[model samples]
Target: MRLTMLRGPLLVAPIALLTLIPLLVVLGSFLHPQPEVWAHLSEYVLPEVINNTLILMLGVGCGVLLLGVPLAWFTAVCEFPGRRFFSWALMLPLAMPAYVLAFVQVGLLDFTGPVQTLIRDIGGDSSWFPRIRSIGGVVLVLSLAFYPYVYLLARNAFLTQGKRALEAAQMLGLSRAQGFWQVALPMARPWLIGGLTLALMETLADFGTVAIFNFDTFTTAIYKSWFSLFNLPAASQLASLLVIFVLVLVGMEHWARGARHYHSRIVAAERIQLKRWHQIAVIALCSAVLLIAFVIPVIQLLVWAKSILQEDLDSRYLGFTLRSMMISILAASLVSLLALLLVFIARRFNSRATRWMVRLATLGYAVPGSVLAVGVFLPIAWLDNLLIPIAQSMGFATFQVLKGSVAVMLLALAARFMAVAFQPMDSTMQRISRNQEDAARSLGLNQRQLLWRLHLPMLRGGMLTALLMCFVDVMKEMPITLMTRPFGWDTLAVRVFEMTSEGMWANAALPSLMIVLTGLIPVVLLVIQSENKQD
Candidate 1:
């Protein structure tokens, strides 16, 4: 308690710049929404937006549960020949953005696509296959990419519970099916729901995927209203609705998890062996998911690239992409540093209020990126108005650079990605023993010295994980950047969205490819680390 109280400034100082501003934006939005926008929302726009959002949420919720649990089961309990490889391979889809997958799916299944061509060759009408540019395709793409969230959580939960209880159920009158349904599934429910919530959030926050498909979801609606129609108030109103939906879903998850009463036993359970048929079934299931979600779409993207083989890329767009990357890198670093502070403070205090602070910080994760954009922008712009004048009076003329510059881009990225930074730090802090801090204190180390000498060393890997995730997150970001970016600023995601919207697939495809490629790096590192630890 002493250490925690004394260390507040060190833990809280870095985040004060971030935490104070975003809330000001959200508050301003609520208090000052235009009357005309409120009328539009109350009459028709809000209902359609809310319905479409819920529909997408329901679709992803069901799809992820179907894929995530079974795939996790295959790896955790039942073994297939390539189960080892597939266990990690399934995570590859996670590296692909929904918008990228949207383009790939459309190219492969639209009227002029290869599949339709092959069908026409077989004396079949291409109309036999539904167009991929619809709600169904959006759901399909989102579920495939997002199910890995469920798989990761569910698989770990299963391994943690182990098989001891599973065997005892077998020794009783219960069959394997009964035991799994009644025993194992309940134990994994918390993890499954947690994964489901993540998938739902991704689906809800998605803009590129739904927009490319011509869907009317909240994310797309906001992009259209704000950027295309120049209706800022309308967009804010829509974004607020999206935020409410997300809060409800998150609340339900919290309620359900809090309601759960099961306890996981500490002793390791004997691992279950898969029957021959079960092994084959497992392999087939994983293969089918990968084919639809990853393999087919990737093949289609490559095929499309073949036609653009000789085209010279525009120098301007290339520069745009490079500019985006640099900003993303810097913003990722800043977000991670501030998040490190928040996580350390939360863990150090480890009290009800501190825990709530940590949760509120992560609340940015559930709010649509567009909502977070609103939350971050208003106060920051106001702050700049104050700071720039003071600096100019002090004979510093260029301090005006922050008003609508790359610095704003970096701060927006930090507000959006604070959650990503908090997650790994939270997990790592949980594993730290209190005795280490006690031992350091007994050795006459001050709080700062103990943190630097003891806690920070043990947390390097987790901090790196947080930093890398933030880097990739900002790299693929679109919604918040679209809303908050300074004039003339462009990101790879923005470039991809722009090109795809204009039917310039050839250029869009490259940047989409770049986005996925960048997202893959941190994921690859994390996977290798996971594999190494398992070894």
Candidate 2:
């Protein structure tokens, strides 16, 4: 038994090391102070970057809460038209990347775009409209993109809490409004905060959206520090700061969620009957959000894609699509494999040390991709410097080996998405009966045989779900691929970034639409899963 426990942890050692490399590299940047870069950044860059990040987080925090909590409450508890459809339809926005939405909104709503042009042709004053290129616009775009995180969790929280909590409050002589504010809302606080945390993390990690809007967040700062300024240390230092901010957010969320569980009775609570006008209002709000966030953006993408289809559709795009799929498949497979191993080790060992190792391995998902890009790149670059000389001595003329290869990108992607794959597999693995495992062992089956025959067969559903989720995530990923891909290895995301950088909105649209379509697959599956659980 002792040897088995030791073996499980030993298997997890490499996974933990992989996760730690980026973190340790980023944190270690402080040791080598680039006095010139710090001097310039301290005066001009850090202030705006930190301020914008804080403001963005604050604005998005408020925006998602206002949008998500109400939508969750209405769909989960209130009786309204289209409630059943809206329950899943609202999650459709998850398929749209914030950057894609950012560019589409800017393309349509900017002063020179068709919307303002139409307004001008009709003799309306366009000067009164707020600029979509500003900080506020970025906040709005991100809020719309990420609110579904809160809605999903908060809706589940409300569904499980049900109207039982409200009835209890009413029994104590409180009205519906007061009951919701004082009892039901507070009961769902942990979930609400959890969802808010996820939205904020996405907001913080955002590079493409902020890049499109010309907003100076930590992510963009990190990117500029590396690519524009050609300062790796500066980039690593900025990434470290962002890592600090993410850690703070994670710590706060953990503290907020401490030892709290407010479970109401599981019986189905009757939906609240709303007045006639109220239903109309509810329907209007839900429709507006859906139209603005998902429907309108998709429609506009089709229009833009159509305009540039002839010029842009070629073997180039075929390459882009193939490269995106190839890398996504490779990265997803690697992440799923690591996640499965971690799940198995954690389950088999069931020790505190093993759990800690699993947690460390999965923590990479909390770190932003831009940060991971820097962290992964620096260590690999160092390794390349060491290996190139040895290779040259062996008569192998290689200037660089691992620095910009697909293998390095796979490593970074695997680190960034380990948790996305882990959560589903872990949940599925927990449902496997222990008695089956014991029976397999009692039949003199070795551990490898048992896992191959019993666990692998049972975990097929989870494995597919994990693989699909990670594949789509990698396909949509930008910073890691943008920073780490080999020469001429452009994915669809990189294509979008390149076109948007040149102010070619129409050219960006086809790739954006393709990405959105690919993204919808996993989301639809999630909706089905949620519906099954509800039933």
Candidate 3:
């Protein structure tokens, strides 16, 4: 009994630290926030922030569904020449970041841009094409990059839908359209909501994309409060408000999913078939989506990228690229490891509180990094302040723990990217049977032995998925790096944003391409894993 008691904590220590980091940051901020900050913020800030966030969330949510669901429906029911490519091609937008796509589109389509310049030279002016910087443009850009979130979920849901159910619908005198509406759509609503919720959260949390367009959402306000005004307390207040908005969205998502769990009536149902009209529809649908999502933005990037080569691609930025990749890879791998440990512990103990905490921690995925930095910086800075003075007072000479170290960056990565790492592992774990563990226990195996032998092998793919996802997130992440990076620590994302901030694309494209390429690794892997599961 003594040994078991001792071992439990020893086993549980990792989860404690994982949870403790964010908790410490949030609580610590409340204790020692920025001085004299309450007087500065306008009361109007809160309401405007909340309304803008909700508007963006709702707008992006609607736009993505409009684009994703039809494409998914067409591709599911229809056959086409590029049908095989359409199956996965629709998911490609996920590899591109919203801000990058947004800027690239503006660069190509903006007045005095190459397109407009050509138009003006040949008898055209400002009124020739609408500016791509308006709210509609923002909505268009977001929908393009984000519709993949909906596509994947809805497509998977459609693919797994049983043929028998649809056949029964036909037998009941329902037409194909009626069957899809009454039978298929209801079954797929859960999955569709799951995707829509993700896209909604993403839109609410986006800072860079909104800011570039001069949109004043809550995330932008938080960044202004923290970086421009240098008021950490007000930023926290704003962030706290932002968290409420996020939670409301999250709660609604949870309520929707809980209310709409779909059950299959028949076992091992047949796949639905597609025909020639479907082929034409699928082709047109895929082309339209890709036109908005991948082709237009990429063509714009290619244009700017060529101009960049005309500018410069020297040695100064090369080291930053290496540094960025090295740090992101390390942070991603570390967080993935931490997530596996936490998930393993959660599985063994079956703690509802622990599961809730894990779910809460993943809320970072939905939060803008600008806001998360406040959440991260508040507690650690307070802790660091207390420790640095004590360490100097005690006359130690080793190292400082928090303020200006890679530890802070890594901790931020763990806090932010944990969800990406945990999700795949959690899904994989659910698919596994407990018999292997029971059998191992009966055969004189320790828990560690059983896990190493049985669990690790089964979860290898999930582990890879988690690691790659985390790595890509780390690579593309910006807000935390901007706020919490140590004195001279800049990652690939930071460098890209910095160059783009100056309206310089030549220097940014290499790193931007790398970020997109890096993000694609996990996306491709997930697509393959999804295919394998289907097979």
Candidate 4:
């Protein structure tokens, strides 16, 4: 018993500490002020980055609410032409990364692209269309990519309470719109805010889409500071500022949701009846959202990919594909195992410390990839410096030890995505019965035996789910992989970034399509799972 107790803290402490060091390192940058770099940043970069980031967040927040809430409400409660299909299909856009959509829209809609070119060819003016490289374009793409977060949560909230609220409102002589505004919408406030919080966090953490548009944000500033200016301290300082934004958002979410049991009865409400024109209007709205978000981007990607398939189908792509799959698999396997271990420890120990450990370990998902990349690399680079002198004394001529290696990339990825793997496993762990655990203990099963015989088998589904989620995320991840990957270790995302950066839209399409297809696996599985649960 004493040995088992010792094991929990011994195992958990190191993992939690490892998870925390990078964040601490980034936060500590303020102590070591880089005056020269800070002067240049304050003069040339900070103003625009701050202004653009704030505007981007505000725009994305409104855009998602506008797009997500109505779609969620209609699909949840109203009987429209395609309500059933739209409920799940609206989530299809989650598979399309914002950067992928950004480049696709830019490629097709830019001044010299086909859309404006055709307009010009037909003796029409081309300057009137909105530029696809502006702040508005970034907001639109990110909103389409992230609104599904709000939709998923808001729909669930409405499904549970929307119809009941409407019926109660009607009894009180309120109209349907009034019921939605005064009753149902307010009741779903927690879900709406929760979903909005997630969307905004993604917006704040975004690096790729903003980069593609050349729209300046803290994430892009961090990238340029490190890679362009070769100043790690400035990058760390910028990342710390970004971390402040994330922390504030997270704090607001917590305070807003404090002790609120908004979820009432889990009753399935009856679908609301709509007039003919209202039904038609709702159908058209939903169809337009789905069409723009998922259908058009997919078709555009297919068109570009088909054009490049003949020329781009070479050994070079095989290397890119294989490298991407290999690293994704390795990171997924590693993070899933660690996440499972943390879940097991939390369940087995059930202490305040263990809970805090779990929280710290899982906090990585809120930290952006660019921030994590800078935070993680600095410490590893410092350690490399420490070891290089020791190695030289030992007659070894080593310039770099751990810097620029796959291990650093894996570590950053594990930190950035720990929550992704932990959440599902923790939920599954919660469902496990205490009585079963006690009974097994009563039957003289040791801790190891208990885990090996019972817990592992039961957690297989969750483990696989975690693996798939992590795999897809790592495959789609850009900032960390781009910053941390060793030379000559380009993945599909890096390939897309390279091609898109150079304005080679056709070259980027194949990899973007691959990533979208990979991302769809989890979304499709989620839809199937939701259907099963509903059934």
Candidate 5:
């Protein structure tokens, strides 16, 4: 019994410590002073970073709510035209990363791009077009890319609320609109807030979209400080500020959702049906969103890929594809395994300390990849510096260790994505009956046997879901891979960044399309899962 009890903590502590280290390293920048850089940033750059970050967050928050909530409500509550198709179609945008969308939009809509050229050919001046590299453009692109988070959560919330609550509101002398405003909206508040929080976190952590737009934010600042200026301290400091911003947003989300129970009586009830014009309006709304968010962007990428296929399809491109898949598979497997172990331990132990440790381990997902890269790099570099001299003294000349290695990149990926794996595993575990374990134990099964025979088999679906999601996320990841990958270790994301940087949008399209295709696996799985739930 004692040995069994001790096992959980022993298994959990090391992973928890590993997860916390990067955050601690980033936060430790508060103690160190970067006088000259700090002074210059504080007076000029810091305010702009703060202002832009806030504006981006606010803009994305509003944009997501505007796009996500209404669509979620329509799909969940009303029987509109194309309701069946839009139910899954609305989620397609989740596969499109904000950065890829940014490039595609810019390539299509910029002053030098086809749209403006066509307008110019038709006699429109340059001033007739809105700039595609501004704050407004960033917000639109990010919103289109990220609103699915809000839509998914809000749709689930509305579905879970069922028809009874809305009926009750209608019986209370309230109109459908009034019921939605007073009851449905309030009940969905927690979910809406949760979704908004996720969108804002992604926005805050964004490096590629903002960088492509040349819009300065905390994430951009962190990247520039470390890579451009070669100032680790300044980068760390900027990362610290970004972390604080994330924490504050998380805290605000918690406070906004405080002590609120949004549960409705679960009953099988008929959904609200819309009339002809209302149905048409709902269909049009959903179609417009889908077209703008997923269809157009994907079509543009396909066209670009078609244009460059013969020239870009070669050994080097294949190498990049293989490298990306290899790293993503490896990282996804590691993160999913770790998440399973952490969750299993937490369930078996069921202690406050163990639970909190698990929670802390999962918090890495909230930290931006850029910040995590900086946090991870500093310690690994220091360790390499310490070990290199010792190796030299032992007659091993020119031996280098951790810095600029694939291991560091994998570690950073694991830290950034473990939460993605954990959430699904945790939710699945909650649905599992504890009696199964007790039954196994009565049959003389030990913990290991019980897990292998019972839990592992039952957890197959969840584990795969977690693994695929992590794989896709790692494939789309930019900042961590950019900062930590070894020499000549360029992933597809790096290829996209490089080509886009050099204004090679056609070349960037192939890899960008590959990423989107890879990402589609999880999004398709998500749609299937949601449909299964509905069924």
Candidate 6:
């Protein structure tokens, strides 16, 4: 019995340890000092970094609420001309990475680009255009890219609140507008906050979008400290600060949610029908949002891709696609397996220490990828150095194993994305009945047999969902791959970044299109799942 109980932790703890090592590496840097770099950053960089980060967060928070809340309410409760289409179509933006959108927008709206050139030909000066490379631009682009997070959560919250509550408010002499303000909005506050938290975290973790705009945030600061200054310790210190910021955001979100319980007393009623002009207004609003968010960028990419297909589509392009697929598949499989192990052990043991370890293991998702890259690289480089002497003694003379390897990239991806894979599987696992386990145990089956025979079969749908989500996330991931990839091992994201940096937007379109197409897999799956639930 004792040995059986010991098995779960023995298998799970090592994976959790590996998942947590990068974060620990970041934390440990606070004790060490790169005094010159730290002094320079403190004097010149830190204040601007702090200021820009806060302003960007504030702008994006307000923008997402303004765009997401009303659209979510319209689609969830008030039926419009295209509410059915908007319900699922709005989520398409989730498949578009903020960086990709940044590239497309810059391509179309830059000074010498199509928009300004056309305006100039029509007798307007460049001053007539808004800068697409400023902080405000970053906020706008990020808001467009991230509002779907808020929209999805908020719409679902509104949909599930049930009609009874709203009817009761109306019966108390409140107008529909007043009821939305007093009852519906308040009821959905927690979900709204949750979605906002996710959007802010993504905004903070962003490196490529802000980098393209030349907007200095903590992520870019960390990158510059590492690559430009060659100061790993300074970068790690910056990363630790970023982690602190994320922790505060998480804390505030928790405090906002408090300890209130919200339960629906009745099932949701049918959506309310709108008048013709009101329906047209809703349709136009949703269409404009979707067009700006998804359709326009995608059409721009397709146009450029069409122009450059023969020049760009070749053996090397195929190699890039294949390499991306291989890495994404391998990383997704590894993360899903590790998530399953952690979730399984936590469920089986139900111990406080194990649960806390599981929580710690999932914290990597909140740490920005650029920060995580620094965290990953330092320790692996140290290990490679430590092994060199032993290899020299064994006559190999060069025994660097960890540096510039695919394995390190996969490890970083797994660490950064474990939460993505874990949440769905864990949620699904919770629905399983304890009686099934007891029934298996009564038949003399041990934990391993029970898990293999029972849990695996039941968890197939959830495990697949986890794998697909992680796969798409890894495919679209830029910062970690940019920082960690070995030379000549660029993924499509790297290709996009390289071309966009060189101002070759046409050349970037092919890979950007590939990434968006790849990302659509999960979005399509989600829409199907949502439709299934409705049916």
Q: Per-residue alpha-carbon lDDT of model 2 for 1-535, expressed as tens digits?
A: 7887678678898998777999999988867768887898899899999999999999999999999999999998899879999999999999999999999999989999988998888987788878999988999999999999999999988888777889999999999999999998898888898899999999998999999998999999989989898988889888988999999999999899888876654457788888999999999999999999999999999998998899789999999999999999999999999999899989888888788888988999889999999998998999989998899999999878788899889888989999999999999999998998999999998989998999999899999999999999999999999999999999999999999988899999999999999999899988998787553
Best model per lDDT? 2
- Over 1-535, each residue of candidate 6 has an lDDT whose tens digit, in order, gives 7777666666666877766788778877866757886898799989999999999999999999999999998987776676788889999999999999998998888898888999998886878689988887888999999999899888878877645667889999998889999999999999899899999999999988988888999998988888788877788899988888988998999899999987643245877778998888888899999999999999999999999999878889888898899999999999999999888888888766677778878877877898789888989999999999999999996897889899889989988999999998998898888998899899999988998898988888889999999999999999899889988898899998888878888899999988899889889988886655441
lDDT by residue (tens digit), candidate 3, 1-535 = 5554345345656555554556445555546645455444455576666666666776788899998888776555444577667777788889998878877777777775777888888885657488787878888888888898898888777776756657889999998789989988888988899899889878877776887677788778888887888877777877766666766887887887785447643235545566777656667778888876777766666666677765566675676787787877888888788778867877876655556556655656766666667766777777877787678778876445877677777777777777888889888888777876788889998988978887898899888888878878877777777778887677677777777777776567767777887778877885786566453
Which regions of candidate 5 deviate over 4 angstroms?
Answer: 1-10, 264-266
CA shift at 167, candidate 4, in angstroms?
A: 1.2
Which residue segments of model 1 deviate by more than 4 Å? 1-24, 31-35, 259-271, 380-403, 532-535
Predicted candidate 5, C-alpha RMSD: 1.8
- Write down the TM-score of every candidate: 0.90, 0.97, 0.89, 0.96, 0.96, 0.95
Where model 2 places Cα greater than 4 Å from the true spot, the runs are: 1-6, 264-266, 396-398, 439-446
**What is the C-alpha local distance difference test score of each model?**
0.76, 0.91, 0.74, 0.89, 0.88, 0.87
Q: Note the residue pairs that clash in candidate 1.
A: 163-269, 164-269
What 10-residue stretch in candidate 3 is worst by lDDT?
A: 264-273
lDDT of 4 by residue, 378-428 (tens): 999989999998899999998786799999999999998898899888988
Sort by TM-score, best first: what order?
A: 2, 5, 4, 6, 1, 3
Ranked candidates (lDDT, high to low): 2, 4, 5, 6, 1, 3
Comparison by lDDT, 4 against 6, better one: 4
- lDDT, candidate 4, equals 0.89
For candidate 5, write residues 1-535 as lDDT tens digits.
7777677777787887666898899888767767886897798679999999989988999999999999998888777667889999999988888899999999988988988999888886767688888999999999999999999999988887767778899999998889998999898888899899999999989989998898999988888888898988888888888989988988898899898676654445688888888888888899899998889888989998999999888899888989999999999999999999997888889876677778888888888999889888989988988998889999998777788988999888988998999988888888888887788899999988988898888888889999999999999999998988999999899999998888788899999998999989999999998887673
Report the lDDT of model 4 for residue 297.
84
Question: Which 10 consecutive residues of model 5 have the lowest summed lDDT?
Answer: 260-269
lDDT of prediction 1: 0.76
